[model samples]
Target: MIILMGIRDDEQVQRLISLDSKSSLADVVTICRSYEAAKCATSAIRAPPDQLRAVSAYKKGKKNKGHEKNLSTKPSPTTATFCKCCAKQHEPIACPATQSICTSCGRQGHWARTVQCPANQAQCLFCGHVGHYDKCCKTKKKDGRQSGSSGNSSAPNNNKHQDTRINSCRHLGSAAPTATKTPQPLNVLVSYGEATFHLLMLPDTGADVTVIGKRHLEILGIPQSSLQPPACTTTLTADGSTMAPALGIFKATLNLGKRSCPARILVHEGVQTPLLSYGHYKAIWL
Candidate 1:
């Protein structure tokens, strides 16, 4: 693991050792810090202007900060207008839903705007594009004449099975998706007390709350006793996991280049990195 642009460091070496458990630290360091690997990493991170668009979020453009915020603002559907999308008696823009809700599949985050709504259908990632998915997906007989296989492969027939993964799929024909992942240590600094730590933060568009990792709190030497009482909140993690017994929540001033704001963050154990969710994004705009 190159720390930066394929540059090898002690931190990356230790990380490798932890992963393999059996590998010698010196050997792991040698492979990751090879000159060829360093060259490749340097080029990848130093890509030309056009390629940088893929990493647009990291760019600090010359536009006035206020102007930049306006450019990125997604003017929500009118708040006063009832949401025809969800058939909910609420304005679309003000909808606080962090997950996609649709009657068709009864799943999260999948919108109704797809070319075809996949509800109560089986789609084989293997072959039969989509029909109604279960333990086994066989093509239904569209034509009466069949050579080898045909069956009534539609409808929810597995109701007898208490827990099937089908309902977990966010859409019909699609498998349950893992959480969105982000690269760590974002090289972004979080200033607290008088020291600044290069903290890792994932930007989650779907999350309404911002969270700080327990490891970060420990490293910063903040005693859990000092934190407020629990808010009876539980957080869903990206890796299909949950962070429970919310340690506490508090307001802290966060600083980025030329921008600073107070952020309310939920504290939870077992987090690998801090999450910069909607609240954090909104704070930067302020």
Candidate 2:
């Protein structure tokens, strides 16, 4: 009978880390490759971020700054505009606003507002309100019109109430923005075309698709033109947010515990780890 394994919880990860006190998360994954763990090494991918340490000389520090910087706790991109060239999060960098450059606003000689070359001004995506753009949508602006007959005896109090209501409107309209995720690194051996090497993977049940970093593609010796864009998909993170429009997907083999099989992965930047999800866990023969 075939069996499936889900991601390991905190207890399981802690126990596993405690067992091989000396093994780092990556090393432990290798150990699992040797041992007979039926689940993807990604299951034990979490180990308090401490398992991600060097064997030579361990030290204490802050969170995954590399990832934190890219996928930091900062607010998510409010703008849906993506780069026409790279399809990254924002639009400024892709086509910098300079002489004759687009500002993602579709104006010539200024910053382009459109994504494509023949910049076209589109309607507001949010609120469906025409004129204003999505990022600057003000549909839900609070109706702060004060309730007064213009002859109230309490002049000072009425003014104060009006100001308070105005402030409240602004506050309500600006809700807390979604934050980004900082995945910990999980090192593993990835085999492709008979060549194998250790790579720091970020096993995230949160990540919808398992993606290889675009920068790491050079290590695999695959040209960008060789791979096509991945099918449209959505990724949900532990932070209760979704990652959309990953660069592309690729086929690879994950070697874990006497088990190696063809697996599909996604390719992205910012995070160092290769995303592995619970769905990927089912590939393992438990």
Top model number, TM-score:
1
lDDT of 2 at 82: 58
lDDT per residue for candidate 1 within 185-221, as digits (tens), equals 3334566556666665765534668778678788766
Tens digits of per-residue lDDT for model 2 on 1-286? 2222453566555545566455556765664555456355655565355456552134323445556676766787678565554345555655443346443343444433334433232233223222333334344332312344433648887787778766764453333222222334545677877788777665443334567677788787877666667776566554446765666666778765566667777766655655665345324321
Question: Model 2 residue 94 lDDT?
Answer: 50
Q: Give the Cα-based TM-score of candidate 2 against the true structure.
A: 0.32
Model 2: how far residue 16 lies from native, Å: 93
lDDT of 1 at 38: 77
For residue 90, model 1's alpha carbon misses the true position, in angstroms, by 45
In terms of lDDT, the poorest run of 10 residues in model 1 is 140-149
Candidate that scores best on lDDT:
1
TM-score, candidate 1, is 0.34
